[model samples]
Target: MALLLTANVAGRTNGRNVARLLQNQFPAGPRAFRVPGVDSLNHARGQPVSWLVTRTASISGQELFNNYGLKPNSELILGYGFSLPHNPDDTIVLKVGGIEGRWEIGRDAQGADGLWKVILSKFVEASDATYEDILDASGMLQEMLESLIEKLPEEDIAGNIEVRADVVEMFHHYLEGMSNLVAEKPPEARSQVKMPFFALW
Candidate 1:
């Protein structure tokens, strides 16, 4: 099992705190590094079951939990080693509570997955891919707003339309903010990596 908490955030002290919260029990062992462009990371690839703990800012965090079908508030966990490349645009898959879902976390123009899986995973628990088969998180978010407007009662319809327009404007602002976060590099801070949980399967 592994935790992809966020991008550009690995082996932080907070990560250690979060790891302790995992529900699955595993043996204590020395922690190791498996970051991209590192030897440990390469060796772990395709090896039977290793754990990864990642931390991203809010946007990235939402994407991981939502897409994987994990509870929005539940700690994020996924099986280690992937059949698909870990590119920004690739659809990462997960099975949560025995239901499978896909999550894409970057912008459409930026060619990354959206974070709708966060809401979808929570709103629809007995999951089906059809819930997320189309519309990545970004698109789904927009559609959700439109759907909300459509469902408004006749008396409230006019006010809802005005609010929806504001939502669209605000969404663009959030997108811009996320773009900046993705582009910036981490500060020169010393972050520690903790031991990863091991599984034989």
Candidate 2:
């Protein structure tokens, strides 16, 4: 009984110490990496897992971007085979006129998750296509987006769609956002949409 009580007390003490260490070492706001301490006491394991927890000078994403030349989510995914789901420095590219040119979607223009509406509005304003073409393309684009959304299930399941839950959820979010934008605008405004990624070609 005495030994059990002693063991229980030691466990509680160890738990408190771990909690304190975590709290002090990882508060929040952009913890990039950690440096481990010397493993001299035991090649097995012990306390003092790591040493210094360094923080960047400024938390400004743009500042860090300028200093580090950070790449956007799209670029990172294509180049590095990984993606930041909530990447603040993300951008999208939309091709125009089949092969004439492309528009690089930036934060200032679309501000993340504004993919569908922004593309339509910008295309209408710039393209030299006729009103009928614009309308047809826009409608077609909406249908395509809706089709993709339908294919992408809301939640992940066992062999349900073969897509990650988070990926499914992310597309569902943006696609729903686009649908809401379509519903929000009037027929005349929607008719003015010009480019629908594939419809133009």
Candidate 3:
């Protein structure tokens, strides 16, 4: 498995400063490299520090615990990698991922003031087309919900309930559409087997 470690230091910081900070904070293991940031590759250019931990290390289960002091079967890696600086204006993001799992450290945009965020994400491959489609649909649904919520009056309880009902109705419609598709095709010709409605929920 190929493991990648990346660190992005934003606001009044440079790639050199980030590289030095990581080196001082996590003195162990191979050194990290300073590379140009690819977040805005087409329009704006940026320089971000990053590290390729290893290409062959096992990142699954007990291997992570034995190698990086991480909890077994969990992708979270805290108190082991580089430490975050104590500057409020500066934001530092750390990401580690491989074929087995992925993890990230940053700030929570939706949380309370000064709240830190640590995320353990599941690795999804590009070849998993169905999973990718589901993720895309989920993102679209989230955007629709956010737009609807923003237009709703905060003091209106009935409006809130209406929004909830709308979402539920949309879910029911989706299930009904799926059921129609299944009914239109023979069992052997169906792309996917029909799952129980409760299981889908």
Candidate 4:
């Protein structure tokens, strides 16, 4: 008989780290937690990926935003705009197709019976000034998340059990690498970028 040993490693905890960075920027509220495996990390090179989240209030809960408007089957469409690189010598205007996202309410938003929805846009910038482009991405992402948080009440997620451990573990596996974070091209590559935060409002 032959015996085989296998190793199973868990995700890392950078949730606390990134959450601290977010907290430093805003006033106190529900803590920020990050998780990886929620979305696929190995995406096609050069393509941007958007992670759909129904409710920051409840991960397992339905979406809170969806309940206000639209029926259970209704849909919300969010726009995502991106700017790609073009030479100064070129006279033609540049416009890339935006990525569309949807938001829906489920058991997590309210209760099993209640429903909610979210509609958000995702954008990307691929100009010669890539660093600035990422900053723009961060700003856009932060703006959207902040707006969503403000639309909801703190009570929705207040004191609810936080998925801090899940966040920390996921961050370690997916978001903690320089190679993964930045564009490789020079001039645009030197700039620093930050991940957007979703805090309790």
For this target, which candidate reaches the highest TM-score against the unseen true structure? 2
- Cα deviation at 40, candidate 4, in Å, is 35
Candidate 2 lDDT by residue in tens digits, 136-172: 5466555644554465434334464587665555554
lDDT of each: 0.32, 0.41, 0.31, 0.28
Lowest lDDT block of 10, candidate 1:
185-194
Q: TM-scores of the models, in the given order?
A: 0.15, 0.29, 0.18, 0.21
lDDT of 4 by residue, 9-104 (tens): 376544444445456654564444334333222222233222222223344443222122221211111111111122111111112235333322
Pairs in steric clash, model 2: none
119-160 per-residue lDDT for model 1 (tens digits): 444445424634243223324444443443454334223443
- Scanning candidate 2 in windows of ten residues, the lowest lDDT window is 1-10
Q: Residue 45, candidate 1: how far off, in angstroms? A: 30
Best by lDDT: 2
Off by over 4 Å in 3: 1-13, 40-201
